[model samples]
Target: MNEITVSLPDGSKRSLAAGATILDLAASIGTGLAKAAIAGKVDGNLVDLQTPLADGATVEIVTEKSPDALHIIRHSTSHLMAQAVKQLFPQAKVTIGPAIETGFYYDFDLEKSFSPEDLEKIEAKMRELAKADLKIEREVLSSADAIELFRTMGEDYKVELIQDLGAESVSLYRQGDFVDLCRGPHLPRTSLCKAFKLTSLAGAYWRGDEKRAMLQRVYGTAFADKKELEAYLARIEEAKKRDHRKLGRELDLFSFNDEVGAGLVIWHPKGAMLRTILEDFERREHLKRGYDIVLGPQILKTELWQRSGHYENYRENMYFTTIDEQGYGIKPMNCLSHMMIYKSQLRSYRDLPLRFFELGTVHRHERAGVLHGLLRVRGFTQDDAHILCTPDQLDAEIKGVLSFVRDVMGIFGFDYEMELSTRPEKSIGSDEDWERATSALLSALKDSGREFEINEGDGAFYGPKIDIKLRDALDRRWQCATIQCDFTLPERFELTYVDADGEKKRPVMVHRVILGAIERFIGVLIEHFAGNFPTWLAPVQATIVTVTDNQIPYAETAFNTLRAAGVRVQKDFRNEKLGFKIREAQLQKIPYMLVVGDKEVEAGLVAPRFRDGKNLESMTPEQFIAFIQDEVKSYR
Candidate 1:
């Protein structure tokens, strides 16, 4: 046998026969690693532990403790689900099953939807197969042979997949009576997946083509330990309880009208009030950050979007129309108009970093299925801004943007992850343009000491981007901030500034948003606080609840005084009991409730009760107003 040299992360090497498997290498090291091993990363490619090695290669066994091991467990758990489904519902055809951020899902085309009962039965079978501990075997075969096998098994979707694979040979994973076409580094046995759960089911098209058959996708998540699994499930439960859609209706913050169509939100009066406060807050913050406020028309000629590249690469999401034989589009983005504003006059290098900010509302036609209230909407306002600067100013500008993003997210109490999305397969711009833009983004991120991951081939056709994933209070992440570097637009629009030498140089364009949307941010805020907004941003910061009819006059007086003091106080003067009023106020999550009963009124005092139902000692109306103002000031 030919000798092979295998290297480990610790700079250790072992000589072995050329066909040595990860399991063989691990045994050569110790039984402890071999048992803990789930897969191996061979020269940057993840492969099964049983995979044979070539003459010379770098190898590292992926144990349960490795960062990538959990994903492997989840992916293999997805295969176990397929095996369980096949054993119970043989007619279902599997298409794709991949591990997602927090879970795994398998899409299948079947005659009927799998109900809760069906899931229970399938889960029982899954446990049985897991107990059996069937070894997962890998096989490589020609695409033609794979197509024939799936065809014979009546898996038309799998057969269709083989045709589109565009590969001569495809790897297949088989365990027990189930077989799946996959490029896998799955767990060696069904028992290796220590903990698993079937999460939810949804409808998805075969290949994201709405015209194709809708497949039933069963989502699941797996973890190495039972406690971790339970923790995940608990987090999911908390997230569901905090879902913005439910809170929006329960708190009467916002609604969607069928006549208004999907993806367009109708902010009720209370919602609007909350939004106004947030917008005002953002405006003040932007002014403090030296951003020049700007605005543009909601609709513009098609020629503008064409120059912006929105009509070319993102036309599907844009709404189009015509005015007097000239094509126009509902502005899907604000960058183009910002550019035209810049090009209106020649700019000197002294005005190098011109930052223009806008609370711009734009419309895009999102798919119907993906629409979920403010989170995923068509017509929404973005706290959008554009920065046009010289190449020398790139690093400082991005760092400034990052600081701005951090401040906005801090106001919302959001923790976030950063991602640098590099060039896509189909993109414009010269190699130098791409290189410079990419370097500037990375430089800024490193300078800020922010740790970020890369998303390859997910950038805009025009340039690379920095995406911020803000995690809510429930620890659920949402992509709410983005900084994109665009080179194509500047070139297309011929946008340039005069340098110190009086030479015309194209300015680098940056698109950024801190709080992505006022509407969506409101939704997020609703969930983050469970509809209990900070006193400053609350629609009704404090409510004056009268104890009886006689106290109405006193309550009204107190309300008038607070309103004069600029407090959002509501007069709940109904003839209900004091306890009843307190309960109502608590349900509304009002920050403060000032109860004016007979004693308090006669004493010229108001008994304060926090919305949390914690009763504070009775105090003079003057003292009560002062206390509320302090709370609002602190934004607690």
Candidate 2:
């Protein structure tokens, strides 16, 4: 008998036959583990339980306790959904199914659309199939044979996918009567996908091309157990209530119309005020940190973009215009202009670490289907900055950016996590440059003592980056800040600084955004605070209400006093009931309300009430101004 040595993660070894499978190994260790195992990791790569072991290979059983288990379950559930859909509607042709961050979705081409009831039927069928516990089997077939088989079943979409793969052979998974072409590590049986539900349905173009056939995409989610699924559904409900778009309309912050075109935001008066407050804070903060403010033209000549590599790598997402036979490209990034500034004059090692800041608005050619409120927009302003530093200063500059992100996010009361994204498949620059850049970011993150995850192949086209996603009150994560380290752009533009040895060397660049996009940050803030902004950021910080017509004079005086003190104040001098005015103010999400009545007028004081229904003791105009200033300062 041929024997193999299997190395465990804990440095233990087990002697087994070379042909033994992961399932066999698990059963040998413990029956409980064998039952819990969904898959196995052979030398760090996920594989199915039935995968045969090799000599001296390290193996780890992947169970429900594994971090990757949910993704695997969700992916397997997507396939089960396709199978169920096929069983219910034989006319439907499945295109692709994949697991997403939220859950899973499968696109299908059918003559008729799927109604809500159809989703129910498909879910019910999935449950039935799970109960049947059908064994899922895998096979490898020649591309020709696979295409012929799918073609025989009238699955033109599958045939097209297989033909496009351009591989000699393909992997296929079959469970009972349904089979799918996939490179998979699916659950051994359908029973593992029991705790799942069909979420919603939408229309997606085949291959995302408008000219291609439009397919119906069915979204769903699966969990390890029923309780987990229920918890996720509860979060979904809460997310709906905290949706920024709903709050934006309710609070009259901003709007978008067909007349203004999609993905373009028209800020209302209150929204503009909110943005103004944020911008003022941003400018002051940047100045305090020794950053020099800068501005760039909206559209630069196309030749400049080509020189910066944006034309080659990012042209698809950029807007280009031809003016009087001359070509120009609207800037999708602020880094280009910052780079030109660096090259404008001779820089020495002593003048290194130049930080340039900009509140620059940029336009992107985002697809219409993906645009949503202020979160995903065509035009948005970024709290963007770029730093040029020598190689020796790279680590410190990265740490400075991290500190800036921490402080800004703290001010916003946002709990965030960092992700170090490595070089992407389509990115430029040499391996050595990417390696150096990634190392600097990693070292900075470690030195900061902040926990960060690695997101492979999700960096910018020119460099590796650290993406900071903030967690809202509802625990939903939003990507709002990023710190990117680039070595390619400087090289592309031939940027150099005289070193201590009097030799010119390429300088490193750091492209970072503290608040990502102004519009998106506002959207996140709206949801985070549930439209009830804090005193500092509130559009209407305080509202002065007169209890009676006689108190109008005092209310006017109070409003004027607060306004002169730099508070965003509003006045309600109508003959409406006092309670009605207060209720309206509370509904408008003002942080404070000053009530002026007979007693307040006589004492030359104002009664302050919080939007939370807490009343403070009466204070004179001077005292009230001092109190509000203290509170605002505390927030800053």
Q: How close is each model in CA RMSD to the real structure? A: 1.7, 2.2
Candidate 2 global Cα RMSD: 2.2
lDDT of 1 at 18: 78
Span of 10 residues, lowest total lDDT, candidate 1: 627-636
User: Candidate 2 residues 478-590, lDDT tens each?
Assistant: 99999999999999899999999999999999999999999999999998998989888999988999989999877787888888988889999999999999999998899
Q: Which parts of model 1 have CA positions greater than 4 angstroms off? A: none
The global C-alpha lDDT for each of the candidates, from Candidate 1 onward, is 0.88, 0.92
* Candidate 1, position 614, lDDT: 88
The candidate that achieves the highest lDDT relative to the unseen native structure: 2
Per-candidate TM equals 0.96, 0.94
Global Cα lDDT for candidate 1:
0.88
For model 2, what is the C-alpha lDDT against the true structure? 0.92
Worst 10 residues of 2 by lDDT: 553-562
